[model samples]
Each structure stands twice: as C-alpha cells, then as structure tokens.
Target chain A: MKTQKYIVIGGSAGSFKIIIRIIKFLPANFKKTIFLTLHRLKHVRSGFVEALSLKANIPIVEPKDKEIILTGRIYLAPANYHLYIEPTKTISLSTEELVNHSRPSIDLTFQSAAHSLKDNVAGIILSGANRDGAEGLKQIKLNGGFAIVQNPEECQVLTMPTAALKKSQTKNIYSEKQIIEFILNCK
Target chain B: MIKLDDIINFNNAVKEVSSYNLSDYSKKSLGRRIEKILSDYKMTIDSLIKKIKLDSNFLEKIIKNITVNTTELFRDPKIWQSVKYRVLRKLKNKDTINIWHAGCSTGQEIYSMLIILHELGIANKANILATDINTDVIEIAKKGEYIYKFNIEYIENFKQAIQVNPYNYEDKIDVSFTKYFEIDRVKNLMTAKPFLKNKVVFKKYDLVKQDNIFAEKFDIIFCRNVLIYFNAKLQKRVVNMFADVLSKKGFLILGIHESIFGAEALKYIKHGEFYIRR
Candidate 1:
C-alpha cells in the first residue's frame, strides 16, 4: 500500500457533531487514514468510537502502535494519549507532557505531521478553545500541506478554527459536510 | 493614565483570552498583556479589531504569543522507562493498563509511550487518555504523523537520547520517510501522515472547570511540562484536580523540569525525569 494518505481532524466544545458529519459524508470505501482529536475528560467512558463507527461508512478503530497504516480505516486518539506519526509510517504514542494542559494536543500532532507528512497530508481545525493547533497548522501550510478550518461563524466554539484561520494559510474554509467532501475529493 | 481606547483593546484581548469570559481574570494585568501584544504587532485597537474581523491569521499570531505553552516529548523519560521496567513486571498479570496522558501535546510523548508499550508488548492491553486545553494540538496529535525536516539530522541524536534504534526500524520497512512525507523542494517544510489516532481518545478539556474533569480516577495521570504556565495558586489548584482524580498509588508523571515540590500531595517519588505518586 502507498501508505494511506493521512487526514487529521481536530475540534473541541462542539466537535462531536462535526466529526460525525464528516464520517457520514465520506465514501464507504474512502482509502485514507482519518485521525480525530476531540475534547473530553480523561476518565469518562464515551461511546464516541462506537457512535462514529456506526455512522461512518468506513471501519473505525482505536489505532495501535506499529500497526500497519491501512486504507479506509478511521482512527481516533484514545483518551489521554498524544498521537504522533513516526518516520516508519507507524503510529508513535507519547506520554511526554501536556502542552497547553492537553495531551492528545493539537500542536504536538500538527507540528509533527507537518514535519513528517509534508504535502501528502490534510489538516483541519474545528470548533475549539485556545490557539493550540494554530502554529502547527501554520507549519503544515508552510510545508506545502493542505490546511482547512471550519468557518468560525458556523462553530459552536469558534476559538480553535478561528485561531487556525488567523495564523495559517488554510486552503479552504467550510462547514463540516463540505470539509468531508474536500477530503474525499482530495483522496 | 491608560488610554481609553487602549482599555477597550485590553478588554477585547481579555475577552479573547478567556473566550469572552474575562470576569475571572484581572483586568489591569490582562490589559497590560493586551497592550504588549498590540504594540508588538504594531497594530492600533481599531486595526486589531479590523484584523480579527478581516484577517484570522493575525488573531492566531496574538493568541500563540499570549498563551502559555509547557510541553516536552518523553518529558521525564526515566519515569516512563521505570514504569516499563519496574511497574510492568508487577502489573503484568493485569489484563489491561489504562493510562491518561493528561495534556498530551501533538502526541509526541504519547507516541513515545505507545512505542515503549508496544516494545514491552503491553500496548494491545492498554487504553490511553490524551487530553488537552488546546483541541487544535490534540486534533493534530491524533494524526500520529510528523515531519522530520530540521529534526532529520537529529535522528541519530534522538536515538541516542532515547536509546532506540531509529535506523534499525527503517531497515524493516520498505518505505523511507521520504516516500510518505513530502519534503519541501525549497524551504525547510516537511509534513507527513499521522499514524496514532487509532489508539487515542482525544478530547478538549479545561482543568479550571471541575465539571470538565469527570468524577473518575485514573491509573496514571502523566501531566508534564504544563504546570509552569499557570500562576502558583493555579498550579496548586490544578494539582489538586489531578490528585482528586488519580487512583490511589497511581503514578503522576510531570515534566522532567517540573516539580510538585510543595503541592498538596502527601509526598512525591522521583523516577527518572518524572515525579511519581504521593
């Protein structure tokens, strides 16, 4: 496999709806890796994966380290782990330390992906608080990757997407459904 | 006297900082910070608002400079390394090990943990909790992918620092980092596909809000490098939040550079780069 193209989705406050919308819009046989970061408590047991899996046309699974990157699989960052891509195209997890008081932090992932994935990637920042992924997304755009942001007016919590749009050169700004279409089309 | 217009700008800045909830923060200090930001950007209050309305990029730049960021990958490697050697042996019989990577950034440290656990053969049996105040970073972290431009030369140094074989792993894979990641043809741009979202449950959380943090306890709350940003009182308060939510005897790994020195914890144990259970 040509190391499935990577799509990163980040959001907070009201990301649940956006994430599901994207999953629903994706083609059943979409051949890319979908990584998502949502805002939730560390200890709460959420049916997020199950919920998304049911709605998504593709298989949704919590990723495992060294698991071969496959096409058509949707992966979520399990609660409390910073998700990173290794040079080997294998998943690398870190227990390092929080950035902006968040683990599966947006900056950490986006910065690493910008450093590793380069132009073969797509980054989207959704409704959220703080400016976490702003710098990372900036790096992504600077690295020739496609950057997108949710229209702030459309977000329940516009801090994140607004911040991203403010700092980086996003290739497109869309509603959740449009974002999914863009990703699918890109693939 | 502070300019009336400046005061308005400061209020706007404060509103932005706390997401329009400046009721809790001190106006004077917040205003000073905002003034500094405005001056640095060479923007008038009117210009600033215009930028916020017309240019989202300017807003992000202001936010990045104003926000406090405390992050490090494998922050306290020793604590994690110890967990691998000492704790794993004792907890081996347990079917699963749930870890909370509290405030996990871009997931670098989380990736390190996953790599270590996978090497330890304990990953399949583990569940990770990656949370952060910045959902932007968390979303990016979920990608599990990174670019290695400036850091490419550090591959050997990173391996040496972490005592892992970066080159050896490449030998097993058919694709080189260059194959999947698109290196900038000109500038130092590098980006790659994320590989870790499959295993993490990323969420946005505000530690200041008790409701945001659930009523459950965790086996390990690896909160590192983030405490330094908050004022001392806030740090203590946040530590209490961790202490309240942590399972008894469960480890709390802080950044190697951070210390719980005089927090409310009964006591702390140092293991490598982290400070563990009380």
Candidate 2:
C-alpha cells in the first residue's frame, strides 16, 4: 500500500475561480488530502466555503482546531487564523500576528506542510498580487517535496507565480489545464 | 532543525524541573514555537536545555514566550452580536450572571464583554472572572491598558457588534468609545475605564492542570482562541472539565474556528458558534 500524499494549494487575489474549476475537476475518490490557504477578509467569513462547496465533488471543509486529518477531503484555512499541518496528523489553528499582511497565510501553511510531511507533500502556488507564497514554495522544494507554480503568463495576476518561480528552483510550472492534469496523473 | 524528539526532550526537562507540564501540547505547534525561540536567541537545543535546567527564571520567561497572547477587542464581531442577542439576552433575568473567561489574554476580551453587557443594560448584574497561565498577561489584564494605534482597527468591530443591528439595517445605536475607554493618541494608550475593569477579577490559572481554583460553577464560559495550542486528547480533557463546572444549560463559547469533539462534544448542544451545556 502506498502512503497518502498531502496536496497544498495557495492563492490570493485572482485564484478563486481557478480553485473552483480545480475543485469541480477533481474526482470524488481522489485520495490525497488537500489543504487550501487563500487570502481572505478577516471579517467576512461565511460565504467562501459555501460558494466553493456548491460545485465540489469531494467534501470541502473549513476545519476546526485539532480536527483529525483525513484523505479524500479538502480542508480550508479559516479566516483570521493561521492553519498548521501537525505531525500527529491533525490540524492546528493559530491566532498569531499576521505574516505577509495576511492571516491564513500561504507561507505558514505551506512551510508547515513541508516541515511535517517532507517528501510526501506537493505545494502549488497560484495567481495573486503579493509575494506571500514565494518563500513557502522555496521551503517546499528545500524539504524534498514537490513545488509547483502556475505559469506567470497563464495567471490572472502574475505577481504570485512569478515571485514563486524566482524563489523556488523547481521547474514544475503549469497552466490551469496542465495543473489539473498533473494532479490527476499523481499516483 | 528542531525535530519531534527535541520537543519531547524539552517537555520532559520542563516537567522534571518545574510545575509546568507541556507534554500534552500539540507537538507541531510547540515545535514551531521552540524553533522560533532558538532562532531568536541564537541557541541550540542542548544549550536551551542546559539553561532550563540551571536557571528557573529563564525557564519562566521561556514558558511565557511559548504561550500565545494575541487578542483584540470585539474579535469576530458577529459572535459578539450573537452573544448580545442569543447568549446574554437569555440570561438577563437572573440576579447574578457568572461568566468565566478561561485563558483570557490581555484584557481586551473582558472589556469587550463589559461593553456588550453595559449596552444590554445588564452590566451591574454580571460577575466576571478572567484567568490565564501567563502571569504577565494577567497583570496586563489587570492594568487594562493597551497600545491605542495597535488596536485602532478593532474599533470597527465595536461598531459592527454594538452600534449596528445586523438583522435590521435601520436600527442603529450610537455608542461612544469614551463610554468604555480613554484613548490618548499622544501617549499611544487606550485605558479601559473603571466601570469596565472594576467588575472583573483576574487570576493566574493553568487550563492543562484541570484544577478549578474558584470552586464556583459558571453560567457562561469563554475559552476563545486558546484550545488550538493543545492536542486532541488535551482538548477533550479541557472540554470535559468545562462541562463538569458549567451550570446545566450553561454556554461554552469557543473561538469562531475552534470546536469541541469526541464524547465531550455530546455534553453540549451546538447553537450557532457556541455550545450550550445540556
């Protein structure tokens, strides 16, 4: 039996529609545990999960603190909190000061996944206006995990993926369709 | 790199040398905190362990740094709005409403509650007890002073929770900031007025020990944003402890994203963002 894979997808400004498309594309039986950390307004908390869930084939959850990690489900970072992937296979939320001017920071979640799961992780950085996910993608590569970014030309906002490409040496840049194909092709 | 083994060793060393028991904290969060401490101080794990063994004062500072004290007034304004309409309104008829703020950090939350209670016209009937493991934070909570500019953004939360009625857009109540706090921009200080700070008692208490020092049952308990530091097992234990001390049909208010799970969750009825003790 193969070990489970942890897939982390991070985005900001322009990645929501793309995320919905990805969620719509993935099959219900997808075995990898998916973690989504998106930059969101701290006060507006209710609509994001519900909107994402409308077309999702797999279960989408904004996980509570210390919730057990399970395969075949998507976990979202709640607003105004930093989400961490624990070594004990549980999720932990932190109210620490914001990093990169964002809570549910892409860097925190990606770095945590890299540190805890090592080579069993795949970190994907998508379109955004800021440089929050850049160092995190670098950490993912440094930890022997797969680091991927959407191609800058294909991104709605090029700063995020471009920064990620400059920081992380990984050559696994993909278009939206190619990213979906890459996820589907994973064993 | 600080591994899980290093965290385990640190926990054991702290347990043997002091009254603190950190073995129950979530390893991933604790490990991250330890790694930050090591980098901040430029010390190795072995050196950190040696300092912990030799100096009790340094150990206390390390323990204080380990616990997170981040908080704001009227955090998650919607929850406060729910508290005004849902929780406190239900308990308004009682002669004395006892509320416990477990793990209350730097006093903003307590003041936030006082503002709500005052607005509801039930401030005088409430008795509040706030506690935390960190003595430094307890003192800050006692002082009821904070950096004005640092917390200026949360004033919007005040307007959202107190001034504007969510259900009715036309119904608006004008509440002044001067009613609860005195903000001095020149000095960069916001001090909670006497009426808000006088009703609450502050103390140093550790939730991990499961000891109820007050020996009094509470009508409502606020343990917001604190349980995320503990593992599932410890979280369950603390939830059960809260269940034991809460009055029948009392409320347990956790953080917006925090939850009670396992057998302990059955003791409370989930109502919106909070749990009602059954």
Candidate 3:
C-alpha cells in the first residue's frame, strides 16, 4: 500500500490563490504533514501564514529552524532559505546559494522531502515562471513517490507545469478543482 | 532500490574510514547525500563501499561536502544591531571579554563580530574562540582572508540582512563598508586586518559527543545556524552545553529563524531579539 505520509505542494508567481483554495479544503484531522514551498522575495515581510491560517482548518505555520514536523499540519517555507526535511523529521533551513535564482526554491524542498520520505511523498506542482520544481518532481517519481502537475493550459504561467510534465511520469494531471480532490483523496 | 541495509553498511563504512560516527546524523539527510554522491560520481552503493575501503581520501571528500552550510558576512544584520545596542554597549566598560563561535564556517561571522568590536573600540580587550568540525574550513578561518563581494549582490544582501535603522532610514545615512573591511577593489580580494585575527583562537571541536576543549567561560556565544541540522533532542543537549559553559550574564545567540523553546527556554532571558543567560 502506498500511504501518502507527506504531501508537498510547490508554486510561484500566480499559485498563491490556488494554494489558498486547496488548503481551505484539507480537514484538521488529515493524517499527513503538508508543506508549501512558494516563491517569495527574501526581504519582503509577507502575511502569508496569517492569511492562510484564517481559512485552513489545520494549523498552518511558517516553520522555525529545528522545529518538529508533526502530522496533520501545514508548513510554509520562510523566505530566503532552502528548507530541508531532516531524517529525524525535523526542519532544517539552509541559506545556501539559490537554485533558479530563488531561495525557498520549490525544487530544494521537493527533492529533500522526496529523498527523506521516499515513496511516501506526494508532490503537486502549480503555476510558476521557472523550471525549479520540474527536476524535483521528477526526482520524486524516481524515488517511488506520486506526482501531480496542474494542467499548463489552466495555469497563469505554463512554463513550470510544462517543464514538470517533461520530467515526471504522472497520470494525475488535474486542474485546480481536481487537484483539491486529489489532495482530499490522499487523506 | 536502496534498502535499509545499504544505509547501515554505508554508515559503517564511513565510521571505519573516518573514525567519526555517522550513526546519530539524520538518516534522511545521509540518504540524500549518499544518493547525490552516487549519481554525481557514477557509482552504486556497493561500488562506493569498495571505494571507501580501498581509497584513503574518499571519506574526506564526502565529509567536506556533508558539513557545509550556507553562511554570509554580517548575516541577519538586525541581530548585529541588537548585539551592538543591547549586549556590547552594556559590556563596553569591561577590561576583558570572551566570545565563543561554534560552527563558525569559514569565519564570516567571526570577522563580522570583529568588525562590531572594532566599531565599538573594544577589539583590544576581546578574545574570540572560533571552531568548526571541518579542519579545512578551520585553516581558512585562521587566515581571515575573504574574496571581494560584488557590489550589486553586496548591496542586495545588506538591505535584506539589516533592519532599517530608523534615523538612518529617515536621514539617509549610508554605511561605509570600508571601515571594517579592507577591500582591494583592484585585486578583488578582501583581507581581515591582523588585529581581529590575532585575538581569535581557532580549534576543531565536535559539538556532538566530543570531549571538552574549551576551559574558559565565555561572555558571549554565537552558535547560529548550526543546530537546525540536529533533531530536537540534540538541539536541547547542545544548548544545555552552551549554558554550562556560559557566565551568568553571558549572551547566547541563535540563527534569525531559530528559537530556544521547551524546558531549555527557561535558562535564557530574552532582550529585544537577543538572549542572555539567566
């Protein structure tokens, strides 16, 4: 049985609104840990958590370094650093050089989680301007994890999903509404 | 497919070669590194095991890449400003100061601290103890030579690193980067002055399961951005060790995004983004 122990959703540019809509549907009793690795300016102070928490039934938090990763919760990567899921299931943040000109790069989180969690990882790629998550989503599939990419035709920017499609062997292509259903089904 | 047995053998091979235990490091991270090394070098786990046994220098290459974390100069500048206004200024009258920098990768923060002490004119009175687990990084730290930073990147990092100073933002006073750094714009190399490097004693001490190397109690300890690699239990153990070595008024600093939570939080008193031993 392929149990979805971890769910990581990634996006950039125009994916925030879609994420909020998706997050709003996840129940508080969801049995897996969820991570949101969205692209944002390192210097800008964003109210992302406060905004998401208002609608999310489950706890939505911007993780502090060394913070424990609990089940049934949502974690947003803070800006300006690469977020890693350590073996102990705690969070490790690295300000290492940016990949694809972005810190909190979706690829870093997705790749780390895929390596650490292995087959238990389920990844979803959303609208983005870059190809960061493409390789990582492919890595997830290589590690025996499941992958879903938002249909490029439905995305605000098609490059990210299109790039992800080139690498990932996913049959679970879905629009925004269907992606929400896929998330709920994982629970 | 990589199985649990492969991971166990890899850790055993690492221990046999380096005499350092990788058993306690997060298996997830270790696995990631192992996977990367395999693909990058075109070797399977079994071949890598053979390389570790036959090749003497193989372990060193893996260890160096494993321990490196992101570090920058005067990183998270608000913390420096807080140190300046709250901690250093309060201790200015002291005849001597002891500062311990744990996991001081390549001495960026050490130079940054030296700059702060120099700006405060207390550089003469302070003795800094800087250490990292990596011997190579320690050697570089001892030299105190930094390559020049590009202006655009430097300015961008500076803006993000520092919290806007109220008066400086209002009055538009700019920071003169040259005051603390000796920059050779032509040679594209910046070397930290001798006065700062002279005061620092660099040692190789492992924070995890290592014997005590530091005998002197410190007035300030900078253990920033290192603990995130460890699990919660290890984080507590390391922080408690810091507390044991700290003086009553000693300051303990963490990364901008790290916190002193749980029972360990009781040992420190928070003061405007800085923490002091209670």
* Model number with the top lDDT: 2
For model 1, residues A1-187, the per-residue Cα lDDT tens digits are: 1222888777777777878777888888787887776656643424768877888788987664334567788777665566766446655444434666777788767776776788887888999887778988888789878788998889888888888998996758888678867777766
Could you tell me every candidate's TM-score relative to the true structure? 0.46, 0.92, 0.82
Q: Rank candidates, DockQ, best first.
A: 2, 3, 1
Better of 2 and 3 by DockQ: 2
Q: What DockQ does each listed candidate score? A: 0.03, 0.75, 0.49
Candidate 3 per-residue C-alpha lDDT over B40-123 given as tens digits, one digit per residue, 9 for 90 to 100: 789999998888877767777776666755666777666776776678877788888899999998888898788778766899
| Model 1 chain B weakest 10-residue run by lDDT | B20-29
lDDT of 3 by residue, A1-187 (tens): 5768899999997898899898888887887889989888554545767888999899988888778899999998987767887567888786655778888888889888888889999999999999989888998998999999999888999889989988886777899998888788876
For residues B108-218, write the lDDT of model 2, one tens digit per residue.
Answer: 889899999999899999989999999999999988998989778678888988998887889998888778889889999989998788899888888988675766778
Candidate lDDT values, in order: 0.64, 0.89, 0.80
Among all windows of 10 consecutive residues in model 2 chain B, the one with the lowest summed lDDT is B208-217
Colliding pairs, model 3: none
Q: What is the interface RMSD of candidate 3, in Å?
A: 2.5
Q: Which sequence of candidate numbers ranks them by lDDT, best first? A: 2, 3, 1
Candidates sorted on TM-score, descending: 2, 3, 1
